[model samples]
Target: MDAQQVFALLCIGFVLAAFDKKKEHFPLPLLLLAAGILCSFVPFFSNIEVTRDLIFDWFLPALLFVAAYQFPYRDLKKDAGLISTLATIGLLLTFILLGISLYILLSPFLEVSLVACLLIAAMLTPTDPVSVVTILKQTGPQEAADIVEGESLLNDGTSIVLFTLMSTMYFESQQFSINSFLIDFLLVTFSGAAIGLIIAFLANKWMHLIKDNEYHIFLSLLLAYISFYIAESLQVSGILATVAAGLFLSRHFHVNGDKEVKERLDGFWGIIELLMICLVFLLIGIAGGQQPYISYLYYILAGFLLMIAARYIVLALIMYLIPFWRHRFHFQDYLILGWGGMKGTISLALLLGLNAGGKNSEVIFTLTFGIVFLSIFIQSLTMYPITRKLKAQEQKKKESS
Candidate 1:
């Protein structure tokens, strides 16, 4: 679909959502996804196709930027230690466990080598910020939500680092070297951050100079794409760049501006997010239509199992090793951590980008899409109940204390 049609559908969807009582109970991602699926069945709309470039180029940066822009930087800093551990060590643990499990269990019928399995595992490691933040908005107790958001933000960088390294190794049959991996990872991450920071600084300065809300609003949208483009040109992680730029802009803009600027920017980004959310989810469903149904079913089931089992094992191991985390961790937190790690567009993009000759490429993509769907719909819908129970238990303990 063209941009105008997409925008119009988004307006209708948002308006319907605003009026629909059922939407309030379900996660917005799930609702948008359903709309996309419904659109696919329509007589003429079945032929609608979105290219990978549109999603990667037009949608991703804006979505990531808005997410980063809205992030509470101060809260993120306060929980940096916990968030870092989850994003880094926690991610590594999950990756190794999931990769090994997939290789062992699905190797027989899947016909993929160990490296290919690892590549797929790494691709599915990142959590969807769009879904997580949507869930956070529905649930109260902002503390737990902040932790999930912070982990999701930082972990995207970590997951992408692993994905790039592993994908290179798989496709090139290159041997592992810690130094080589570190060099590439650091170059991408550091360059992304450096570029994003520079752009954010310049953008903020320009906004201050203009001292006009309309100009600031338009510039903010431009800043999102500019930071991403610059990062991509530098051969860095453009998504991370957008995130960093967003957080920096959000913090500096608040400190430098009055309430009106903040309000205008808030409304502006909200509209951007609403439009992007629909487009992204629609893109996701359309992407899924390319996969054959039969082959993907088994792999999807296997992926679902591997992802969940690996998550539980990682959470248990981490909590056991870290006494502080053990003390703080609750049953519901464990459940949410495993379930809330929904895989979205990032996974879909990587899966589609997989070389066609790669072992079981079609099967792998189908499985990846299935896992992504389950992650967003099943886990996202259930997270609220898990959080509610955990919060209630915590309250009970407080009363007893």
Candidate 2:
């Protein structure tokens, strides 16, 4: 399908999402995904593919920017230690535990290598950003929302870097060394943050210099892609760079700009955000058709199970380690966080970067895609109920007090 045709489909998907959003029972993303899968069967959309280059260069940075920009920096700052622990330390622990389990359980059944297992774990490590405002909590607990959203934002970068590290080891046969990995990890993360901060600072300054709001929007766009490209070129985490830039720019970006300019920029980004969400999930659904789902059923099931177990274990440890975790968080809070850790576009995008020569590429793709489907359908679908349950618990405790 051509660009125009793809745009048409995306528009339709957005309409569907809007309608689905009205229905409390229907999960918007899950509906979009289902619609895309059904559309994939149509003869008109058979050739449509979500290319990796397109994802990295354009859509990814934009999505990452908007997410970071929209996220409340104040809340993130308040939960900085908690968020940082979950995003970095907790993420690695999840990857390690999940990877080891997948290796032990699936190695005998599936011929995938240890590196492939590590890659899978990395893909599952970060909570998908698709689930920003849990539909279940119209006015959810701010603390829980803060931790969940902050972790999702920061962990995307960590997950991207870890995925890259493991992919290099698998594809290039790079010798795996913990010391070297630690250096690479630290360098990549810090460099990405530094690049993002520098770009955001410079770009925001230039934006203010411009008299036109149109130019301001244009510069914001430039900042996103430029940060990503520069950081990637330097062998750092471009994902983090884009996110950092977004967070920095939006944190300082005030609503008190020239009315027309503010409106125009908001309108532009609003459209971009809607279009990205629609197309990304639709593309996910479309991609699923090409896979051999039945063959990897076992892998999909096992991976999903292991992922849930891994998230639970890591969150529990983190909660235990932190002195005040119980002071603010309860069992339902942890449950929501664990289950809300849905996998989405980024996970699928990283699979495309996997070595084609790697063992069972088709199987990897299928399992990853299947797991994503489960995450959206199962986890996201249940988030609302969990939120309500937690809210009720909070009310009971307050009344008793």
TM of each candidate vs. truth: 0.91, 0.92
TM-score of 2: 0.92
Off by over 4 Å in 2: 21-24, 133-139, 254-264, 397-401
Using lDDT as the measure, the top candidate is: 2
Give the C-alpha miss distance for residue 7 in model 1, angstroms: 5.0
Global CA lDDT computed for model 2: 0.79
Residue 394, model 2: lDDT of: 83
CA shift at 97, candidate 2, in angstroms?
A: 0.1
Candidate 1 matches the true fold with a TM-score of 0.91
lDDT value, residue 49 of candidate 2: 69
